[model samples]
Target chain A: MNAADVLDGGVLDAARALRERRVSVADLVAESLGRINAISGLNAYVDVFGDQALSLAQAHQTMLDCGYDLGPLHGIPVSLKDNVDMAGVVTTAGSAILKDNVPVADASVVSALKRAGAIVVGKNNMHEFAWGGTTANPHYGTAGNAWDASRSPAGSSGGSASAVAARTVFASIGTDTGGSVRNPAALNGVSGIRPTIGRVSNGGVFPLAWTLDTVGPIAKSSQDCAVVLQAVAGHDPRDLQTSAEPVPDYLAELERPLAGIRIGWIHDYSVKDVQPAVRTAFEAATATFESLGAIVTAVAIPDLDAIVDALVVLDAAEPSALHGRWLRERGDEYGPDVRAQLEAGFVLSAVDYVQAQRYRTHIRARFAEAFRAVDAILTPTLPFTAPRIGQDVIDIGGRDRDVHTANMQFTALASVPGLPALNVPMGFDAGGLPTGLQIITPAFEEGRALRLGHRFQMATTFHLKAPPR
Target chain B: MDETDSIRCRLRAHGIRETEAAVGLAASWLRNAARVRAVVEEVVGPAAGPVTAFTHVPAGLHGEERRERR
Candidate 1:
């Protein structure tokens, strides 16, 4: 099969075709690189591995010819967020400070993807140091939204989501700390799964908030995400944070029936500061869940306001500590928002940081208590749709607020507690932007979230609906 | 000293050159910290035992630290 045919079929489809010898591996990589170059205006990629990708594909094809099965992701084109290491490539983390900081070894996640015979198409652009909600990086040109060229792709994982939405790559890995990965996916109308903390290794991935950080998949659909997860989710010796817990067969669980599954709808958390469009879409999503034979019930997690406040402190403080010396010496080199936030961290007392951590312990325990009663919790992935590029302030729910604060409110529900949260495309709002329904499962239970998401997609055609080309 | 002055003093002590916006953000976080503590007190109760920070790094990885502490 030709490049165009394989490129249009997506990651899982192309992988199947490659295994059957219906499509050439080299042809798929070439098509992915061509698409990357064609959509260069989106600023999705900071670096394109055209030569390396082709070489890898050729090698994988030879292995396939020798009757060697490399695994599910064999011959698939995948992008890594720039923060992730690719050995020889400079892992910029979208910051000038780390502009020339190349790693001597591939990140553990990168090794896993390579082992699965996946070609690293390029390093996707992100908010500098994965600090901001919008991909409006001052150092690198902003990553444009796939749906509308002029709008923002809510990020730190903006480019990854944009690339997936535009169908440039089958999937991309992005780190989530306070809604980075899932935010971009939600805004761009794609599947993004932030697995529970320690479920996936973070060995070579750049840290934002070490305690809250997680590497996750941003793909065309939840099933595609599961395939990627199957390849990458496991205990890695390199990352101490990776739990010894066994990685479940995520793809196998996707086909399970949703009948009798209890989905918790935290009414207080779900409705707070939610935009009218989002509220409408989320209500419809819950109704659809009920129709699918899943029992959806309203539940509560206490001290939510305190939890949000604690998250802000922890998120800001950790990055501050990570970038403290740089902020002191090269303060002017950082982006305005990042620099300001870093400086704000220095202004915080260690007492405040400690208090936030203490609060985090309290919040996690509360979530643990709530999860015992339900299999999954449901909420809107974002409070509102993607905002216009360079738009910092927005009127959400009739109250003006910082765009990042507003975008993070719903996604943070999962992030703060470090749970497995999956964003599935629910439907489009009145403004034509996609709305995402978030399904959050208990820690280390990614299969539960993916299964529910897969069932939702099977019942509805939302994930299949492409962005307006 | 006033709140702004106190914030400026704190920033200076931290070796961060104070700007109006940075000071403002700092003061805001300080306010948030107070509110957070209040909520924690309300929910978990005062005289609450100190909770260690959330960390996923396994204890085995901190063997060196444990040894050093001993």
Candidate 2:
């Protein structure tokens, strides 16, 4: 089978083909490498593990021949964000300073993916140190949107989402500190999930913000994300923050019916500042839920705006602490945007960080209160669709707003409370850019979010739609 | 000195030297952080403790065992 034909069906479909011996693991790896090279202009990858991937694929193929199966993701080709470590590979975190940094052992998540028989083809490009939303890497080239080359694939998981949208891989692991995974997934017109904090281990993954950092999967559909999540979600002794809660059967949960599910639409705060097209798409998604027998209602989150603001302090301070030594000794090697943010972090007083943490507790209680009336809350993933590459400011409702702040508005709502949020493509605007509907569930209730997203994908073809090649 | 200079001095105190333009950017970020801090302090009372988690100690490392060892 041709590469396009093999990858077009996504992880589960490809898994079926693999089990039936229609395509060998080597074939999938070769096709993924070819596609990565073909779309080299997108800058979707920082380093391609061509030979190493093929060798691993052959070993997996050998296992299959010997009547051994490693489960659903067996032999599936996927990529990892640059910040995720793969043994012997340079984990640059999309920065120049760490270009030569190599790990002796795989990240716990990488080991999990390997144990599940998933092939790691390459490392996706990201915003340097994940301090920014745009994947306009100053060290590695900027990653372009799969839908429109001149537009951004909202980042720091830009390349991961772009590669998935472009069908270079079945799925890619992207980390979220403040909506890094879901934001890019939304802009790239794919399905991505930020598993509740601690649902997946963060061992060996470079830190952005310790409290909010999470590893998640971006794929063509929620079911595919579930498969990836199933492989990676579990306790790791290396990561003390990882949850001891049992990892639920996410794939099994996807089969659950959407009937009678209480879906809350955060109408006031979520819809107040969105672009017209995004708002329209959000309404349509809400209506689709209602049609699916979900009881959709307006839910108010009074502290939403304040929580978003407080997140900035934590995002700035925590990462600054991690990068303090580097910023002080070798600051010039850092990208301008990341360096400035790190400098800003140094200026924040300890009281500011403490206040932000207190605010996190305050806002989490508010979310818990709202969750009492609803199973999940819905909002537009971003206030606007993917902006033009290199554009820092965007016009929303006739007022120009900073792109970074606008991108995080809806995403931070989930991040502040470490809630599980899924970004599912709803529809496209007139310009053909996709709009995403975000489903935020209570902490450790990622299955609810996945079930809602999977049902939405089953009812609509938005997640299945590919960008024009 | 102005706010930008004040921030530049702070950055220097942290051993980071940047150009004038970068310092200005850092100043804006500092102002933004300050604004967020103010909003958070307004809503969060002193009675509310910071959201912090202590690292998990092993089963036998604490309490009676540690007391017995001492």
Candidate 3:
């Protein structure tokens, strides 16, 4: 097969071909590098480790010759969002403050990937310190949408989604705090999974909001996401938040049928004020689930708006406390928007932060109660498709809403409760931009989300659709 | 002190030097405080103390495999 065909087939297909000697690891790495260099204008990658990637690929080939197979991800070239450490490389969490801060050890997730034989291709770009949803970064140029270069790939993990969608890399690891990973995946038309918080360690990832942050995979398909999750999902001693629970075989769960599964849709909160196209696509997704023999039900949760308000409090205050010293010493180094947000965090009283957490416990109980009657919950990942680059306000259901709030509303439902959520490409809107279907499962039940996402992909061609190059 | 001035003092106390932008941010907070207060009164119990920790994943729940709880 040709290089384009092999790369477009995604991580799982490429790995199968490698094991069968249909393609060389070095040749695959070369193809990924060539694509990365070709799309430099996307600003998806802040740094490309071409030599290191090739060296790693060569080493994988040597291991294969010795009959030592590491795993499914062996020899696959993957990119890391800049917040993740890579030993000697500068782990700039998309900020000038950490410009010279290089780590001496790899992040636990990165180490797991290395052990699984995945080659590190580069570090992807992100929002400055992951403080914003739009990756229209001041330090690194924005990561443009794969469907339309004039539009944004919503961030802070915009680069990883863009790189995966553009076929520059088979998959990329990204951090999600308040929908950073899934928003970009929705806009760029790829698969992203924000695993249950603490399913993967946050030891070496730069902190945005430690309580809200999670590292996950953005890739070509839900199956690819499961493979990546299988490699990285486990407990680590460094992160106290990580539970000592057993990690399941996520890849093995992907083939489970959709029959007899119960899925819930909460229309009041999930569909309110959404774009018409997104609403239409979401309705079709429910119909698709029903046709696949899954039982779909409508459920309601109390005090959703209150939960969101409390989330705003928690999201704001945590980052403020974390960046307190840096904001005081080098406040001028941060972008004006980020600086404004940090300042807003300063104004929140201790009472406000405590009340928000108490509200979080309340909301957590509500979701837990809802989950007892269903296997998963379904919603639109974002209210709309990719907005025009630099467009701050968007029209949603005849009302003007800030792009950040509109992009974050649906995704934050899962984020607030620390549930595992998956963003699957549903289909394209009128303007040819993709709409996303979000599947959220109970905490640590990432396999349920992936199983449903895999079944959806099998019944549709959305995951296989390529952007106009 | 007025609402804006009160926030300006807090900003300075937090080592923020600039007042104009921070004050503008403070105005929004003051506006939103009414809504935040309503939620706090309704959902947050009076006896509830400051939440210092979060239970991310329940201990007994394993991923997909239902392993015996530790």
Candidate 4:
């Protein structure tokens, strides 16, 4: 097969071809680099490690030639969000202030990817310090959506989703503090997973909220995400917060049918004030799941608003504490939005922070109660489709809502309780932009979410839809 | 002092200088935080614990043994 055909195929397909000697790793890397360069206007990449990627590709090819196959991800090309550390490379975290912050060692996730024989193509751009959802970085230019360059990718992992959607690489890793990974994945028509917090190590990655932050995978398909997750989801001694629970066979779980699985539909909170198109897509997804023999039940999360407010408190306060010294010393260097957010964090009282933590326990207990009757919960990833690139206010249900707050409403439901959530492409809006469905499962039950998502993708063609070139 | 003044003082205490407009925004955020805290306090019991608590048990034993004790 030619380079384009191989690049267009899924990661597992590429893995099969590699073992059969149908494609060379060097050609795949070259095609990925060429594609990234060809669509420079997308601004999906912050730094393309062309030389190093090619060298590693050649090395992997030699390993395969010597009958030493690494694994499913062997010889696959993937990108990392700029916030993740790659030794000898600057981990900018999409901020001008951290331009000189280079680590001598790779982050634990990066090391795991390397060990699986995945070649690191480059670093994708992100929102500054991941403080906001839009990937409009002041220092690294705004990353555009693959479907429409003029629209937002619903960041902070915008660039990673864009690359995956544009087929620049097989997959990319992104950090999600508050729906960063899943948000962009929805907007860009891809699949992304935020494993339960502590499922993946946070070592060498920059902090947003110490407790809320998680590293996750964004890819073209749920199966591809499973392949990537299998390589990276495990405990690391370097990150003390990582779970000691053994990582399950995620790929093995993907082919299971959704028969008899109970999915909870948040009747009130998830559907409130959502755009009509998003609501329609979510309803269709619900119907599709029912058609697959899965039982759907209406579940209410009455205190969802309070839980989101608590999320706001913790998300704001933790990042501010992390950047407290810098905000005082070099406050002028940060972008206007992030700087303003950091300043707002200072005004939150100690009582506010402590109450938010207490509220987290309450919300988790509520979800645990809900989970006793349901195996998983389904909701829309975002309340609206991707807005225009730089637009702050969006109309939802005839009222203007702030884009930053609206984007986090449904996403925070899972983030606050540290549950595993998956974003899968459901369908397109009238504007042809993609809308996503979120599947959330209990802690350490990422397999459930992936299984539901995989079954949905198998029965639908939404995930196979590529952006207009 | 009024809430805005209190917020401005807190900002100054942290040595973070900002314009009056920015300080006003911060004050608004603080008001919202106050409302959130009240809502949380209404639902959370006196015996309820925060999620960020430190444990005396080691990391390895915190999972199984802690659950057993509970």
Please give the clash total of every predicted structure, in order. 0, 0, 0, 0
Question: Model 1 segments beyond 4 Å from truth?
Answer: B45-70
TM-score of chain B of each: 0.60, 0.59, 0.52, 0.57
> Which window of ten consecutive residues has the lowest lDDT sum in model 4 chain A?
A301-310
Clashing pairs in 3: none
Candidate 2 per-residue C-alpha lDDT over B1-70 given as tens digits, one digit per residue, 9 for 90 to 100 = 8987787787778776756656766666666666667766677677876653322322221223223221
Candidate 4 at residue A369, lDDT? 71
Please, what are the lDDT tens digits per residue for candidate 1 over residues A301-321? Answer: 888886667778888888988
lDDT of 3 by residue, A192-280 (tens): 99998878999888989988899999998999999999999888998888766678888878877888888999858777788999999
lDDT by residue for model 2 (A1-469), tens: 6556988887887888888888989998998999999889999999998999999999999999898999989999999999999999999999898899999999999999989989999999999988899999999999999999899998999999999999999999999989999999999999999987778999999989999999999999999999999999988999988878788888888887888888888767768798999999888898999999999998887656566677788898898899888887888899888888887777777877887887877777677677766788999999898899999899899999999888988899888877789999999989999999999987767787888999998889999899988
Candidate 3, backbone clash total: 0
TM-score of each: 0.94, 0.95, 0.96, 0.96
lDDT of model 1 at position A168: 88
lDDT at A284 for candidate 2? 89
Order by lDDT, highest first: 4, 2, 3, 1
lDDT comparing candidate 1 with the true structure: 0.84
Q: Pick the candidate with the highest DockQ.
A: 3
